[model samples]
Target: MTVIGWIQAIVFFLLVLALTKPIGSYMFRVFDGQKTWLSPLLRPVERLIYRIGGVREDEEMTWYAYAFAMLAFSVVSFAYLYVLLRTQKWLPFNPQHFDNMTPDLAFNTAISFTTNTNWQFYSGENALSYLSQMAGLAWHNFVSAGVGIAIAVAVVRGVARTSVKTLGNFWVDLTRCCLYVLLPISIVVGLYFVAAGMPQNLHAYQDAVSIEGFKQTLTGGPMASQEVIKELGTNGGGFVNANSASPNENPTALTNLVELVLIFLLGAGLTYTYGKMVKDTRQGWAIFTAMAILFFAGFMLAYWAEAQGNPLVHAMGVAGGNMEGKECRFGISASALFATVTTDTSCGAVNSWHDSFMPLGGLVPLVNMQLGEIVFGGVGSGLYGMIVFVVLTVFIAGLMVGRTPEYLGKKIERREVQFAILAALVTPVLCLVPTAVAAIIPPGLATLNNGGPHGFSEILYAFTSTNANNGSAFGGLGPNLFYNIVTGTNMMFGRFAVAIPALALAGALAGKTSVPEGPGTFTTHSGIFVALLIGVIVIVGALTFLPADSLGPIVEHLLLLQGNTY
Candidate 1:
C-alpha cells in the first residue's frame, strides 16, 4: 500500500473508532428512550408520524405479535413496490416511460429491498418511476434500515434485561431508530448530496443529445434521499444503474468520502453501543478494532493486486494489472481498495466491477464474503455478527478455563452461548453447504459466465451473496429463476435464522445472574481480550474457509500466473 493509502486507511479507521463510542452511546439512548439535543428536534416529527399513520406508541406487542407485525408491514411494502415496478409506465413522474418488470423480476426486486437485500437485477430508472423511487424504494430504505437497527436493539435489550418476556416495543424502537438516528443524519446527508450534484428533480427523464448526436434518454430521480440511507444502512441498492459510482449519485471526491464514511460509521458505532449497553465500552471497541484490522488488510491486498497488473496481460505484454472492471475515472488504487472494503463489510455498492478484477483481486471479495463478513459485516448485521462471534469466543475461553464465560458481567451460559453459536455458525452453514450443493448439481455449472476455476468461483460467490443477504452479483452468474429461488431461500434463512436466535440469546443473557468481576473474571475490555477476540474471529474464518478458498481463489491464482487453463 502507498503511504497515502495507509494514511487514508488509518485516518478513516480512527475517525470511525472515535465516532463509535458517542454514537453508540447515543443509539442506546435512542432505543432505550434516553434524551439528547437531537431528540427534541426529532420528537415532534415522531409524534406527527404516529398521529398521521395511526401508530400507537404505547401499544406494545409481545414478541410474537411484534414479529407478526413486522412481517405484515413488510408484506404490504413488498406488494406496493412490486405493483409500482410492474406498472411504472402508467405512474406519474415516469418521464422515461419505463416498461413493466416481469413478474419474477418484480417479485425478486420487491423481496430484495424489503429484506434490505436491495438486490437490483434491473436498472433503477428503466424499471421505476420517480414516485416509486421515493415512495416505494427510498421509503423502504429508511424503514428497512430501521427494522434491522430495531432488531439489533431488541436482541441487546434481551441480553441486558433480567427474566424479561418482552424484548422491547417494536413500534417504539423502530420509531426512535428512524426518528433520532437514521432520519436526522440522512436528511443532512441527503441535502449535502443534492448540493454535490445528485438530482432532486421533479423534472421528467428527457432525451439528451449526445456529442455523437445519438439520442440517448437520460434518467434522474429523487436520488439524494435514497442515496443517503442506502449507504448508511449498508443497503447497497443504487438510485441509478451505476450505484454509488454514478456521476450524479456520488458527484465528487468529498461526496465519495462521505458515502464511504456513512457505510461504515453506524456499524462501527454499534459495536461501541453493544459495549455501552452491556456496561463495557472495552468490549465494543474490541470488536471495532478487529473489524478495522481486517478491513485494512483487504484494502492493502486489493491495492497491491491492482498495482501488480494482470499477469496474463504481462505475458501478452499488455501494461495494466487489473483495471478492466474499474471505472477509469476512479483508477486502480481507488477502485480496488474501495471495492475491497465495501465488499468486506457486506456493503456491496461497488465503485468498480468485480468481474474485471485480476483473478486474485476478485478473489479477495469472494473470500471476504465467505468469511461471513463479521469484520464489520453489514451496517447493523455486521456489528451484530461480530458480537455473536465474540460471545462464542468467550464461551470457548470459558470452556477451556473450566469456568463459565461472562460477557459484560452477564454470564454467557449454555443458552446464551448456544444462540450465539447459532448466530455465528448458521450463515456459514447456509453459504457453504448450498454452495457445495449448487456446484454439484447439474444446473449449477450452467449459471457460470466464466468457465474453469472462475466458474467454480461464481457458484461460491452466488451462495455467499445469498447467504450473506448481500444483493450484489458477480457479472458471471446468470441468476435466473433457479438461482433466484436458491438465493432467495438463502436470503431468508441468512437473515431471520441468525436474528431470531440472537434476540433469544440476548434475553437468555439478561435472565442470567451476574458474576462480579474477580481476578479470573476474564476482563473483556482489556487489550488482551481484544487481541484474543480478533484471534478467535480469524481462526473461525480461516479454519472454516481454508479449503473452500483454496479450491477457489488459491487455485485461481495458480491458474492465472502458472498458465493453467483449469
Candidate 2:
C-alpha cells in the first residue's frame, strides 16, 4: 500500500488509542451508577423509563436471571421488529409504498438486528419503509448494542467482585448504556455526518435525470441518524443496499475513517473499562495488546494481498493494487483497513466487496470472523468474547503449571472453565456444521453465484459471519429462503449460546471468594501471559477452522496463482 495509506491507518489507530481511556472511564461511571455531566438531563428520563416499564432499577440479578431478562427482551424485540418488517407497506413512513417483507425474510431480519447481527437479505431502500428503518432497525441498533455492553459489564463484575451471587441490574445497566453512552455519542456523530454531506431527511426518494440521461431515484430517509448508530453500535445494516459503500451513507473519506473509528471505539474502550473495573489497567492493556497484535497482523496481510493485486490480472498486462472491489476515494489501504476493523469488531459495514478481493485478501476478513472477531470485537461482545478465551488461556496455563488458575484474584474453577469452553465452541460448531450441510445441498447451492473453491468460500464465509454475529457478507451467494432461515438460526444460536454460557461463567465466578495470590498464581497481565493468550486464541481458531479454510480461500488462492478463476 501507499505511504499515505499507511499514515492514515496509523492515525486512525492512534485516534482510537487516544480516545480509549476517557471513553472507557466515562463508561465505567455510567455502568457503575455514578453521575456524569449528562446526569442532570438523562437522570429524569432514565427514571421515567424505569417507571413506565415497571423496572426496579435497584434490583440485582443472578446470572440466570440476567440471561432470562436478556432473552425475554430479545424475544420482544424480535416479535416487534418482525411484525414491523412484515407489514411495512401499511406503516406510516412508506413514502415509497414498499411491500412487506416475506415471512422468512422478516424472520431473518428480525433475528439479525435483535442479535446485533444486522445481516440484510433485502435492500433497505427498495424493501423497507422509513418507519421500519427507524422504529424497528435503528431502535434495535441502539438497544442491542446496549444489551451487549450490559452483558459485558456483568461479566466484568463476575471477575472483579468476590463472594457475590448477583451482578448489576440489567435494566439499569442497559438504560445507562443507552442514555449516558450510546445516545449522546450518536447525536454528536449524527450531526457531524449531516454536516459532512450525508442526507438526513424523511422526504420521498427524488426522481431525477442523471448526466447519462437516465432517470434515477435518489433514496432518502432518516439516514444520518441510522448511519451514526449503524457504526457506533457496530450495527452494519445499511439504510440502502450499498451499505457504507454507498455515497448517501458514507459520503467522504473522513466519514469513512470516522465510521471505522466508531466500530472499534467502544470495543477498544471497553478493554480499559475492564481494566478499571478489575482494578488493573494493565490487565485490560494486556488484552488490548493481544487484540492489537491480531488487528495489525490481519490488516497487514489484507493490505499486502490487496496491494499485490491479482497475478492473473497482472498476466493480462494490468498492474497496481487490486481495486476491483474497493472504492477509489479510499483506495486499497483504507478499504483494507476498514475490512480488517469491521470484521475484527463484528461491524459488517463495507467500503469494498470482499468477494471482489484476491483470494488471500478476502481470506483476512474470513479468518477474522472465524477467530471469533475478538480482536477488538463488537461493542460489549468483543470484551466478553476475549475474556472467554482469556479464561481458557489461564486454565490451560494452570494445567501446565500444576496449579489452579486465578484471574483478577478470582479462581477460574471447573464451572467457569466448562462454561468458557462451551462459549468458545459455539462459533466452530454453529458455523462449520451448517456450512457443511449447505455446501452439498440443493437448497443451499441454489443461489450460489460462483463455482468451485470460491463458491465454497462464499458459503463458509456466510456461516462464519452469522455464527460470529458478524453481519458482513462475502457476496456471491444470493439470499434465498434457505439462507435466510439457516443464517437466522445461526445468528440466534451464535448470540445467546455464547452469551448465556458467558453469563453462567460469570455467575459461577461471582459466587466464589477471591484467594490471595500465591507463588503458583500466573500473573495475567504480563507479556508472557499476553503471548499465551494470543497463542490460545490463534491455536483454537486455527485448529477448528483451518481445514474448512483450506478447502475454500486457501485453495482458491493457490488456484488464482496458477491463473485460474472460479
Candidate 3:
C-alpha cells in the first residue's frame, strides 16, 4: 500500500523476470541433453547415476512407461521415508534423541515430502533428528522437485514434438534436473544462506538464558542447505516448525529476497522453457505475463488488506496494520508479499500465519491455491497446470469458431481436452469432498481450532492446501489421525492424479501430427489469447470455489466486519 511496499513488490518481480530467460535456456539445454557450462563437471556424475541404476539413457519411454516410472519412484520414496521416520531413534545424528514418529504421522510425512507437499504435521526441530532431516526429508526434497520438473518437461515435449512415440525419459530428466539444475543452484544459495547467519551446522541444541531469565533452547542443524532447496524446489517443509519466520531459517532481508526469487525462479523460468520447447518464446512470455498479472493483483489486494490493519484493533485504538501473527523482522509488506508468493507457487513456507490475516487478506492466498497455484506455481507444476488452462482456452475458442482446437500446431481434441479437464478437476474434487466429509464427521469436527465459520475456513484451507499440493496450514487445526490419514491420501492423489493425466495429455499431444495454422487458428501468443487464458483460469476458479469461499473466508469476513470474532 505504501510506496516502499510497491517498490519491494516491483523489485521482486523484476528479479524473477530477469531470471526467466537464462534459467529457461539452461533448462532447455539440460533436458535436451545439450552441452552447457556445467557439462564438464556434471556429465560424469550424470552418467554414473544412470550406470548405477542400470537405466538406458538412450532409450525413450512411451507415456505409459514414463507415468509408471514416476509413480514407482514416488512409491519407493514414500516407503523409504516412512521407514526412516518410524525408526529415527536408532539413526545417527540424533543429537536431541527425538522419538520416532507414530505410524500415521510417519505415513503423512513421507507421502507429503514424496509428493512435494511437505506438510509438516509435527514440528521439525522437536520431532526429527539430523539424519531424518537430511537423509529422509531433505533427500526427498531434491528428488520430488526433480520429478515435478521432469514431468513438466515431459508435458512440454508432448506439446513441442509431433508424431513422437515418447515424450522423454523420466529417469534421465530427473537425474539431469537434480545434477545440472537443482544441486548447483542450491549450493550457491545454501552457502549464501550460511553467510547470511542461517545455521549450517550439525551442533545440538544450545541452552540459553534470555535477558528476562527465561530458559530457551535454541535448535540448530543442517538448516542452510535445506532452507535453500526448500524454497528453490518449492518444497516448503521447514527445518523447524517456525519455518521461514524463524531467524535461523530466514535470517535477513537479503535472504528473504533470495528465498522469494527462489520460489518463483523455476516456475517462472519454465514458462520460457515451454516457449523454447515449442519454438515460440512469445508463447512462454504470454503465459508469464498472465501469471504476473494474477500475481500482482493478488499481492496488491493482500498488501492493501493487511496494510489497512484490523478494524477490531482500530476500535481498540491500536493502528499500523495487522501485525498479530507476523514476525517483527518481516513487518507487514514483506510478510504479505511472502504469504502471497508462497501460496502463489505452492511453496507454503509462510513467514506470517494466514490465520491471523484480515479475512480478505487471507482470502487471497486461499484463492491463489484454489486457482491451482498456476500464478507462478510450483517449479515444474505451474507451467503444466497453466498449460491445462491454455488447452481449455483454445478449446473454448475452437468451439466458438466451429473448428478443432490446436495449440503449438498440435490438435487439442476430445482426448486432450478430457485429460486437461481431468487434471484440472483433481484438486477441487479432492479438496472439497474430504472437506465436506470432515465438516460433518465427529473426528473431523474434533480437529477444529475455532468455532463457527472461521473454524470451517481452517478445515477448508487444510484440505485445499494439501489437495493443491500446497502444504500451508490455516494455523488452528490440530490435524491428527483422521486428518493426517485423509490429507495424506489427498496429497498423494492431488499430485499423481493430475500428474498422470498431464503426462497422458502430453503423450496424446506427442503422438499427434501438427496441423497447419490458417487464418482461423486462434493465435495463442496474443493479447487476446492472454486475456482468454486469464479469463478461463479465473472463471474456473470462481465457479469451482466460490461456494466454498462464501462459506469459509467470505462469511468470516462479514462476521468480522460486524465486530464478531470466531
Q: Name the Cα RMSD for model 1.
A: 2.3
lDDT at 519 for candidate 2?
76
lDDT for position 441 in model 2:
92
Model 1 lDDT, full chain set = 0.76
TM-score per candidate:
0.93, 0.99, 0.99
The residue pairs found clashing in candidate 3 are none
For residue 10, give model 2's deviation from the true position in Å.
0.7
Candidate 1: where are CA atoms >4 Å away?
52-66, 210-215
Q: Model 3's lDDT to the true fold?
A: 0.92
Candidate 2 per-residue lDDT over residues 1-566, each given as its tens digit = 77887898899999999999999999998888889999999999999999999999889999999999999999999999999998888879788999999999999999999999998888998889999999999999999999999999999999888899999899899989998999999999999999998998998999999899999878889999999999989989899888888888989999999999999999999999999999999999999999999999999999999999988778889889898877778889999999999999888988899988888999999999999889889989999999999999999999998887888788888888899999999999999999999998999889988888989999999999998888999876898888999999999999999999999999988898888887777899899999999999999999999999999999998888787765
- Those runs of model 2 whose alpha carbons end farther than 4 Å from true positions after fitting are none
Model 2 pairs whose backbones collide: none
Clashes of 2: 0
> Which parts of model 3 have CA positions greater than 4 angstroms off?
none
